[model samples]
Target: MKHHDLEILITTRKFFACDAESTEEAVKIATTEARKHLGQDFYSLEIRDPSAGWPETVHEATNPEIT
Candidate 1:
């Protein structure tokens, strides 16, 4: 069998409610929370092989009602 190495990219978006006094503080808190909960909220996925060229998107989640 042949083996290959590939890179995967995951895109996620989530909303967080924080008791912060400033926008900067809110962003910090949200970033911390998001890092702690990685891989739990993903809306898109992409894969690419270094040996190959550009990355290819495999999955994407879209909400028609939001637009």
Candidate 2:
């Protein structure tokens, strides 16, 4: 069987405070929390940087294209 990589994107509605020291840490925490909340099967996750003070953050998911 062939395997493909999956990507997941999570965006927050507002700027939330996090105890993480860096963006990577923050993303990891957010991803974990989101996964638990989502309760679904996923492969990989990517976190996007927030716009200066902007609540809207862009997240992207990539997966194998089906024909």
Candidate 3:
């Protein structure tokens, strides 16, 4: 059997709703919340096989709720 080297990349996104006095504060609140939660929405995935000399394949999530 031949061994091959492959690479994988995953991208995710999360949304947070915050009520703050300013945009800066809202961003801060969202960041803090994101740090506390492990849940994320899948955005895209990429896979590459160097041995095959093939272009990477990309799969993107089509969920409208992600945004």
Candidate 4:
């Protein structure tokens, strides 16, 4: 599979350059990073694996035929 996508929910929405193999794992990492950076005040988080059917970030990758 290709690189995964991760969303870290905090005071402001942010994306982690680090990617996990699965949603469960992604959340784990996000939580850890959040705790370290944003402290325990983080609101929520999201994980998207394009290989697992999650939408791509740039859009075109999801529909390569468009370009």
Candidate 5:
């Protein structure tokens, strides 16, 4: 893959964060450390999964400031 500085957007139900770094360095770090913690199952790891679909559509919208 082409090496570039990029940001990884990581998300969970309760939290989200972005990791910004060079891709080549990031892959080296990710592969090295993840293997230590996850063992041979490193490839199938999942951090979290939130709602699997879109939120219910709201017909009426209300401004939080006005409420």
Candidate 6:
């Protein structure tokens, strides 16, 4: 599969803050709770932990495979 640089918008929650496969997944998980905290705060996903690497690695159009 091709790698996609998805811009994820996260409204503070545990999964997105710790573990999530993708932005869409994170949003889906939060959608129910998000209804209550619509205007809360948000953050872009980042590499905070050492064991992390780019969310996933794959060759995409302009980008080559990381490995």
Candidate that scores best on TM-score = 1
Q: Write the per-residue lDDT of candidate 5 for residues 15-55, one digit (tens) a residue.
A: 32335385445444544454465443223322222333444
TM-score, per-candidate, Cα-based: 0.48, 0.43, 0.40, 0.39, 0.28, 0.25
- Put down candidate 3 lDDT per residue, 1-67, tens digits, no spaces: 9999876545564435668896557655655554455346533333333334556332222335554
- Candidate 1 residues 1-67, lDDT tens each? 9999876655544445769896557556655655465545443322223233435332233333332
Q: Model 5 residue 11 lDDT?
A: 30
Model 1, CA-based lDDT: 0.48
**Best of the candidates, lDDT:** 2
Each prediction's Cα lDDT score?
0.48, 0.55, 0.48, 0.51, 0.37, 0.38
Candidate 3 minimal-lDDT segment of 10 residues = 42-51
- Model 3, position 51: C-alpha lDDT score: 37
Decide which is better by lDDT, 3 or 6. 3
Q: Which residue runs does candidate 6 get wrong by more than 4 Å?
A: 1-18, 36-67
Prediction 2 global C-alpha lDDT:
0.55
Model 2 clashing residue pairs (backbone) = none
RMSD of each: 15.5, 8.6, 15.5, 16.4, 19.3, 14.2
- Runs in model 5 deviating more than 4 A are 1-21, 40-67
TM-score-best of 2 and 4: 2
Span of ten consecutive residues with least summed lDDT in model 5: 58-67
Clashing pairs in 3: none
Question: What is the model-wide C-alpha lDDT for candidate 6?
Answer: 0.38
